[model samples]
Target: DWVNLEAHELNIPKDESTKNEAHWNCTLKNRTVKVLRRWLNERATYDKYQDRDELWLTKKATPYSSKSCNYLLTRLIEEGDVPIPEHKEITWYSIRHGVATHWANHVGPHHAKEQLRHKSVTTTMKYLHSDSEMRSTAVEQIW
Candidate 1:
């Protein structure tokens, strides 16, 4: 329901698809906390709906729908001049998968499952990606 700046955690509300779900606490890294703080300060300067319960608001002080979020992300990427490889696409799910993969690689699948809030490790495995480099490293370690 709220973000705890001191704890560096946010409460993620359960969506309609989540069965028997309550809120989940997602821990934020220090860098994420810093960025969020900066965003809050900056947004307050120009946002008329500062008192609104919604975390994100458009310039017109309206809540952002999924489509608007996608548009905003695309616009930001273009305006920021971020380069994308040919045939490559970036979406919110890309970031989610990246985070899930990082946890699965560095730690373990059980940990990744927790990080991703998946009910099963099998579900978490779908987000993990293994490249040639990782395969090579594993083969070398075995030999």
Candidate 2:
């Protein structure tokens, strides 16, 4: 998978009943192997990260709670002067949604579902709205 579970220290379920069902294998291209290696190396250089077992460590050397990554990204957006078109606020989820939407348009929705790890294509289908231009072209073809 693009995001290798092997690289991240996962919290394995202790309940034996659930353990077998907890994990799914996905594949990423070999192209990311070097990028993954670089991220791991970068993570190692942080202060106070020595005792941390989590995959993503905060700059303060603490383990990332759910909000911390978002907080960091928000800070980066402000610091980097990233222009938000239409004054739209951005979130990680928005990025993920955008990727899934575009991917579904480029590839079929099934591939997008795999990328997003959606159990059902219905979940991915939400992102697959047809563009007006595409709709217009379809109408022309029918005429």
> TM-score for every candidate vs. truth?
0.78, 0.65
Which candidate number maximizes TM-score? 1
lDDT score, residue 106, model 2?
77
lDDT of 1 by residue, 55-107 (tens): 77877778888678778778889999999898987876687898998898889
Against the hidden true structure, what lDDT does model 1 obtain?
A: 0.80
Model 2 C-alpha RMSD to native? 5.0
Global lDDT of each candidate: 0.80, 0.68
RMSD of each: 2.7, 5.0
- On residues 16-43, what C-alpha lDDT tens digit does candidate 2 reach at each position? 2232444544444455566666877897
**Model 2 residue 116 CA deviation in Å:** 1.4
